[model samples]
Target: MSGIKIIVITFLLCLFIINSICKNDICINKSNGFYADYTSLNCQTFYFCFNETLNKTLQCLNSSEPIFSTYRQRCIGVNPLYDECYLVNINENHENCAWFSVQLSTTSNLTYHYSCLYPFLFDLESKGCKHYSQVQCNQRFEPKDACDYHHPQIHSSIDERPCWLIPSCRNKTNGFHGNQLQECSSYYECKDERFLNLTTCPKNMHFSDKSKTCLITLSNCENSTKF
Candidate 1:
């Protein structure tokens, strides 16, 4: 084979490999809401663009009213958890008395169930209430100048209170800071967005997506698979 022809073939092979590796689907540009997957019409999910990371997890906020919005990539009109009653609690006897059942399961002897009160999401892993998105908060209650008992203190326009009331450590310098939160001996870093130590959890412990804390329990970290 001629040297020039060999070079051309090698370049084409490299291009093909690059295309296969970097599959930046155009659907990534869609807004941070529920969108119907073109490949699977019946499956509607949400997407979140955190900086350059495209989190394509199918988080169906409202499973009951699973209606796609007419406007754009939005899913349902609003998150149903925040509509009426808020505060889901299971008694010691494994009795749930919440308006909606966020999670329900049963073991050999004990039954486990988690419920979400208004504006709070029932985190199945943590078995507690986690703060919902700002858009979800706005659905039922308007932004208030003064913080209320149920609502978290509004530090800034972009601040949405995370679960477990862990402070958003984005204020620190644009680098890594170890063990910022004294409660959990986990590392913290500041970038485009700031949260908790997500890179690694303590020995025999795992990070919780609902609370954003290092939990000794393994089941709590199921949803936080990336970390």
Candidate 2:
């Protein structure tokens, strides 16, 4: 190949990888060539390898062709198989939620719209709502706020007020307590036996007894001991 062609090839490859190898070499055992970093943003960004080594990480942000199209071997605005983020441009409404009415070439008159639920965002590859933190999308959406609660028996005596009051807090100056009646959802932060408020975890989330904070849960962990 000509020198100019080789340079072009190298530059295109650089779009996949750079000279700086990341500390966490995600490409340590790969064969070679372009590969997407599916760990977080799906394939909006990717890496290139040669001889089982990761070179650098590159992205497909802020461009007409904003997505790495592995099938086409380059960046493209849209691919029926894996993209909807760019379609976001067609609609000026930039809330975390949106509706897409794309008319695909192969499928005539087939238009569909989508709305991403809270704590989740629209994923181009999956063409569905995925947790925002896990997918690389063009917009931002806030997660649902934690639910609110009042002491079940604010009128009752401090020592026996609620079903889940920690017996330990009565003697201490300040501490946190969990609600067994509303297990994995509600808790209290008390200054001695008197305190301000009762808090609940966000939708579907759980409270961690060890940390006194709301957290994502995958199992019936009644309480999270891990921070």
> For model 2, what is the alpha-carbon lDDT of residue 170?
37
Off by over 4 Å in 1: 1-28, 31-33, 36-64, 69-164, 180-184, 196-201, 204-227
- Candidate 2's clash total is 0
List clashing residue pairs in candidate 1.
86-117, 86-118, 87-117
Give the alpha carbon lDDT tens digit for every residue of 116-138 in model 2.
32233445554444444455645
lDDT (C-alpha) at residue 34 in model 2: 62
Per-candidate TM vs. native? 0.27, 0.25
- Taking the tens digit of each residue's C-alpha lDDT, what string does model 1 give over 127-186? 333343422232233211112213222222223444444334433444443343432344
Q: State in Å the error of residue 153, model 1.
A: 13
lDDT of each: 0.38, 0.47
